[model samples]
Target: MKIIKYLLNSTCLLLIFSINPIRAQVTIGSDIEPRNGTILDIKQNSNTGHNPNAEGGLGLPRVRLVNPNTLTIDSDTEKSKYIGVTVYNTGNAGVPEGLYFWDGNTWRLSVSVSSYGNDGQFLKSDGKGSFDWSTFVMPDYKYHRPTQISVLKSANVKPESYSYQRLTDGGTGSFGGATPSAAFEYLYSDELNILSETANEKYLFIGIAATTRTKTINNNVPRTSYWQIVGIDIDLTDKNGLNVRTLQKNQRLYKTAGGSDLRSYVDLFTIVPITGVGKGSYTLKIKVYNVENTFSRNTGSEGGNFVTTETRFYDINLVDINFILYEDD
Candidate 1:
């Protein structure tokens, strides 16, 4: 197998890309030494919005912020009003008069500052901004990271249940036309079977990778350094207030200096049990925080807030991972 080794020197982490030339399949169940470095988060907000019904209350439902010093809002449904409001620094830091209400009785919730006696800073939603939904506006968010690697075996093998994709033109194709020297590739996410909520009948697997390159067909290249992953938050109830994990320690492997760099490829696979997740669907989140030397100081910033150049925070590419229910398994 042929190998390409391009050593880089910079705070910016660069992912190595290669395509081997072979037509046989190999399975890798062992852990490879992942690239070494520190992982950090670049904040992001979910456009899909959170569920307010999950947290019950008449007025503002207490919401957390990505940074305790950062500002955020949380609201709920009241008697006849479609809105309510709560404000905090996500750090549990309180802002005087930060929390307000639009009783819908005295005001229409849309009353302009001119119409209603205005307070320079007040929470007022014209029904467009406010809903019976729970929303968390975070300052720091991280997406998932996807990697492409080739496995070698003496013979051919069939892929199990891991997700796989081929390199084709605008039209899609399978693993037939690829040559040993060509960069034929596939993708898979171990978390692809997970979901946003937990349901006894529901199951999912989530696989995240870097964004696809337009010029390099079938080549996995990320434009930015980070992306977003949403799954079972594992540590919290709501999917708000982001939590970041770094795989910067993942091992790096490639074909050595004087070898053939070619092989057949397949999707990733894993074994999991279906039990104890609760009633509805659960969301699992994995995001790329920053791709740098990964060996920088202050890896886990207690500040969690990205304020200085030292705070390696950036967004990577991400896609929602899903798992469906099966009749027989």
Candidate 2:
């Protein structure tokens, strides 16, 4: 029975050798001697005498430790003795129960860490073997952080009308997406969803509309205030007087001359914090004023109502109004 001298601590071997001849090689686990081109080979099992591949599997020694993996570390003597030691875990849920080893400092797992998740999903562990695999929570999604949400809305009105009839094509909906929401309606006003109508949250409102009209004016200064564009305003059912946003300070002329065709747009935006008096759903409203058929004639009075032709706050046609509401904070 030959053995690798390095593996055995025994000193009973003889050193007899022929003159100028090489030493014989060592072989183990086989009595027929190792095959050519082999140095130290491990083959058949010692107890069963069958080849290693034909048996159940190769086996290694397992050491049972006393109170393993406490927050208090083990002593150096225990660390050195258990350095490459494999054990069946009777404790420590953070590691696998099948195979764990002490790599001189900590215990390592021999199992897999990728078997719990699928595509578009990731494994979230609680620093233990337990994991939760779910869909990725995107920051830009509406359910996540403060995202820019756009509502595709439109309203139609005649020349000089205060009633802003919400337009509905039976196919379009709020949020500018394909998904139709019942909260937005053509016959009813739009219920702007701004996270929550509660306090401590801030909101921003911006509105833009294109106006189409014609006016007649001779002097550029002796004003023709027929085709007028005013600021956009919002009305809160719970809080009045512009808490979330009241009106924009924008005014323009859609017509300036006798045959001058006017095509203009009105843009208005404002920032509002909800720490004020309003605490309910927000409704987008338009601002209207009664402009007496007054011409700003720099003749006698400073921009006074000179020519009184007709007096009425008639409605004007708004091609489309784009209302954008988002969280400022």
Candidate 3:
């Protein structure tokens, strides 16, 4: 009997030693071999076929995660060893239930829903796998009208002749000697208050329509009369009356003839971008000027000593004006 037992033990040892080493790849639930390059592959035991109706699924280990910043699953020193570990968090203390993974430093929730915002608010992402509630603001639009429109009546005045006399003895002749002085008359002015509630980049649109009338008469002597509308000047100022921007349009209207009565209309519209200027009071002023209005008689034979009777009149009339403010992107 001892001899038979020794032979059996030797046979068993030989059998064990002859077996192949353990395989590096493993599969669970299915009979098919583990896929290439996979350490462990798990699949549903679908006896029918590989379809969406597969019955069984993997149930990850479930645990109550108390905190995400600290290692509460195991020994603190072992956190680095289980870096890619994942589990189903049942929640504990103040933590919410979700799927979590240990990312070497802290446990991060794989999926989370925030309960911080009201019904009308929207969810905003932090670009780092976090979300919060925020209120969406709509664009703002405002309209303003001129508070005052001052119209100056027509006036008769004798302006200098548009001519330059050549100096004889190596002297310089006067340039633009007949140009009228810059006497701008304010046609419209308005004040707009930008409150803190309307906070955003904005655009300002100004619309203006004006009419001008001029009359020039020549008593023979073959003379020519000249008149011009030197465009509009738009000035924008802040609460402290400091000029912010100045826009000018030059040489809008020009007419020259011996004797004529003319009526002209002009429309000035512009858009200005408003930025950097915070909440404050602002003012918009529109002014008009005529830099040239003169008369000159023909020289030579027509320059005979003749009585010159001429009357020049000019006027500006404001038709309509509008100021609009709207938000921009």
Candidate 4:
């Protein structure tokens, strides 16, 4: 009887062990796209008069998880159009992780971290500007400076002498604004200046501005910075995409400021950079927004003109011309 009892007991223990299950807490990594849902409660209660736009329009919610199980939104607005997600963890063990949003063309890192109580609802923004989510992350605005720092590293040109042809919208009669407050501002770097190979001559001119390329300066920080084009070269491409007959080396001041990415400019034939510098001394024809359906050419008819009118020729130094370069990655 004792032997039989021992066998039954052992069998029962084995059965219990086999039926036991292990629970795996999912650490939603960067790829998980959250679903978009309206935070009706916040919307109805918030004081901000602006109606927030909805988040996560694409197949997946625009939000992504960056750190393991750490969800953050990086904003302080109590009610704003924001990326939303659903999760299983709640209560004391459910510390909210950082959340990220994917802007249509690119992924925007969320600026805040949210917490879900035992009820599984995200708490409102924490009142710090850091948590504000109303302004969507713009990959275009990711970096205000140039991405290629190597290009400017060796350049020792004096200020005011170095100039570039800034590109903007031809329609606006000026540069476009990325924000409402800073409309039509120049987008070039004030710290940069360039001299043309040719100067003090009667010829069309172009300007080349400093451009920067960047690498991760600090990786431990979660906030993302970007490589930006920042400035432009003074030369213009004609209707046929050819540069105009202007001297290969001339200078022009890029006076317009503010606004990133999209800007305006005039047609090729008319001289630009009209207002900023001394008359006949500087004019900006090319802008950042010169890209589009309009045909490009090497002549003014095609929105092309001389980048410079100076008598100095750059043929000898052409071999070492640094058109493009990057910093150490």
The most accurate candidate by TM-score is: 3
Which segments of candidate 2 are over 4 A away from where they belong? 1-189, 212-231, 239-245, 252-259, 262-264, 275-280, 288-315
- Writing each residue's lDDT as its tens digit, candidate 4 over 181-250 gives 2222223222212222233112222224432111111211112221112322344333444543222122
Q: What is the per-residue lDDT of model 2 for residues 127-161, given as tens digits with 9 covering 90 to 100?
A: 65445676777585332234345444444333334
Q: Quick one: ranking by lDDT, best first?
A: 3, 2, 4, 1
So what's the TM-score on candidate 4? 0.14
Task: List model 3 lDDT by residue over 150-191, tens digit each.
Answer: 332223111221111211111222222233232334666677
Rank order (by TM-score, best first): 3, 2, 1, 4
Error of 3 at 71 (Å): 65
Worst 10 residues of 1 by lDDT: 305-314
Q: Enumerate clash totals for all models, in the order shown.
A: 67, 13, 0, 81
The superposed Cα distance between candidate 4 and the true structure at residue 310, in angstroms, equals: 41
C-alpha positional error of residue 267 in candidate 4 after TM-score superposition, expressed in Å: 24
**Which of the two candidates, 2 or 4, achieves a greater lDDT against the reference?**
2
Candidate whose lDDT is highest: 3
Worst 10 residues of 2 by lDDT: 168-177
